[model samples]
Each structure stands twice: as structure tokens, then as C-alpha cells.
Target: MSEQSADPAADLSDDVRLPKEQPTPAFFESKTFRLISLVLYLGGISGLGMVLALYYLIFFDSGMPDIHLKFPVSIGGQPVQKVHEYQ
Candidate 1:
């Protein structure tokens, strides 16, 4: 059997870096994490946009290029003004 040096540092390579304990994950795991992060970031931005828009619409004025369906078709159809005949 070959004799090893009594000193622990003697076993180390020339670089002499500390051995990493944790196992490194694959590259795809990192990419998946990044994609999930991006989606959450964009979702938060869109949610904020919707809240501000509605707040402005409520407290402020209207006429913002017709969101549509403000009023549905009346069941009675065309509106007719009642004529008052008082003699």
C-alpha cells in the first residue's frame, strides 16, 4: 500500500479549493425557475394596471372609447315619450 501524508492538506489538488457539499442542479431547473419568475412579475404588473384603471373610472369620469355593454337592449324596444294632454 502507498503511504499517505499525515497532513490533511496533502490530499488536496494543486488548486486547493474547498470541496462543495451540496449537489449542483441541472441548467434546465434554473431556466424553469426564471420562466416562473417572469410570469409572476408580468401577472403582478397586469393586476396593478387593472386596479388603477378601475379606480380612475369610478372616482373620475368616463368616455374612454366605449368598453361596451353599458346598457343592454330594452325589452320594450324603442323608447316613446308619454304625451301629457292637460286642457
Candidate 2:
């Protein structure tokens, strides 16, 4: 008789090595896909903000002052030209 065991369970002993199947990831679950999505999302938001800001600057305007203001403003009855203390 051979030295091997006659039992079926003996064939699957600790000495035997097994092959494992690696799990495949879905497209949305992948790291590359998540990074790409984050880039696109941020880019879209910034682009929209820039476009809105441009539109507001080009189209909207603040109303002009109702009363005319005098130029060469004088402070405390002192003429603006005569004030040479800063010089």
C-alpha cells in the first residue's frame, strides 16, 4: 500500500495552495473615475461663476448721483490749494 491517505479530505490539506480570483471594480467605483469626476465638477462651478461675474460687470450699472457735487473740495473753510502743511 502507498503512504498517501485513502480519505478524500486528505487531498485538500494545508500543504496545498489555491488560486484566488480578484474582484473586478465597476467604472464609477474606480479611483480614476472619481478623480476625473471631481475635476469636472470643480471646473464647471468655477466656469459658471466666472461667466456670471462677467455678465454682471458688462450689463449691470449703478445709478449716478442725483445731485451734482462740487470739485476742489475745501475742508474747514481752508482752501484745498492753500493747505501746504503736507508739503
Candidate 3:
């Protein structure tokens, strides 16, 4: 087996340094961000309000109208007949 080197600096090719932290973006500190955030918040609140209003209209108010439809049905070449007549 080969003998190991005692010097630690011989294993590193160059000196290492920690990376510097970057400053926050200008847009985050601008008024435009605040305006956009407010608009989004209002939009979300209005959407929720509309959903609640629709829920109230559907559940608490006079509900949807009932519909009835009649259609003649036939099988293979047979004439259509009322279902109650057979029973």
C-alpha cells in the first residue's frame, strides 16, 4: 500500500468562499405589487360572495322549476303503448 500525505492543503486545488446573499427585487417594494395584491384579494372576496349568494338562492329561496316530458317509445316494429295498461 502507498503511504498517505499528511498535508491537508495538498488535496485542495483552490480556496473556497461562501456565496453572498442578493437583495430583494425592486418590484416587491413597489406600489404596483400592493395594488395587484389588493385587486386579487377583492376578486377572491367577490367570488366567494357570489358563490354564497347562489347557494342561498338555490337552498333557501324558491328552488328550480319542475319539468315533465312525454315521448312515444316503440320496440322493434311494435307500436308504442302506455306502460300502465300492461300492468
Candidate 4:
């Protein structure tokens, strides 16, 4: 007699049976999060590269020659002045 509806329990049951969870297509699955993660990852990688570069430049790539320098070198079978030349 009220709006000619004989069954209203069907609509009520649909709403009550579902849990209050996040939607399937949510913000976590959006492109914004992916972009931010990529940016942070690249930044960390670049930072590590910079640190390694500085370390190598300071310790490994020193300006030292492979050969040694001998002082008071000899020339023409005679001892010359104290000169440092690579041996």
C-alpha cells in the first residue's frame, strides 16, 4: 500500500553483507604513488653514486706515479747533482 513495494529486504541485505574496506581502485594504486616512489629511488641511487665517486677520487685515484724517483742520479758514468728522475 506504500509506493506499491512488496519486498524491501533485498536492498537492505546487499548493504549489510559487505565489509567496510578500501575500494578496489584506490589511491594506493594510483600513478602518483608510483611517481613518488620512482623519484625517491632515483634520488637514493644518485646519492650513493656521488658518495662512491668522492671516495674513489680521494683514496683510489691519488696522483702517485707507478715508478719510483731516484735522487742523485748518474750521468755519463759520473754522479750528477741531486736530481729526482723516474726510475
The local distance difference test score of each candidate is: 0.70, 0.73, 0.71, 0.72
Top model number, TM-score? 2
Model 4 spans > 4 angstroms off: 1-24, 61-87
Query: What is the alpha-carbon lDDT for the whole of candidate 1?
Result: 0.70
Judging by TM-score, tell me the better candidate of 1 and 3. Answer: 1
Full candidate order by lDDT, most accurate first: 2, 4, 3, 1
Model 4 residue 70 distance off true place after TM-score fit, in angstroms = 15
Residue pairs clashing in model 1 are none
Candidate 3: the clashing residue pairs are none
Model 1: residue 17 alpha-carbon error in angstroms: 15
Error of 2 at 19 (Å): 10
TM-score of each: 0.40, 0.48, 0.39, 0.41
Superposed model 2: Cα runs more than 4 Å off: 1-20, 64-87
Q: Looking at candidate 3, what is the lDDT of residue 66?
A: 30
Per-candidate alpha-carbon RMSD to the true structure: 11.9, 10.0, 11.7, 11.7
2 or 4: which has the higher lDDT?
2
Ranking by TM-score: 2, 4, 1, 3
- Better candidate number, 2 or 4, judged by TM-score: 2
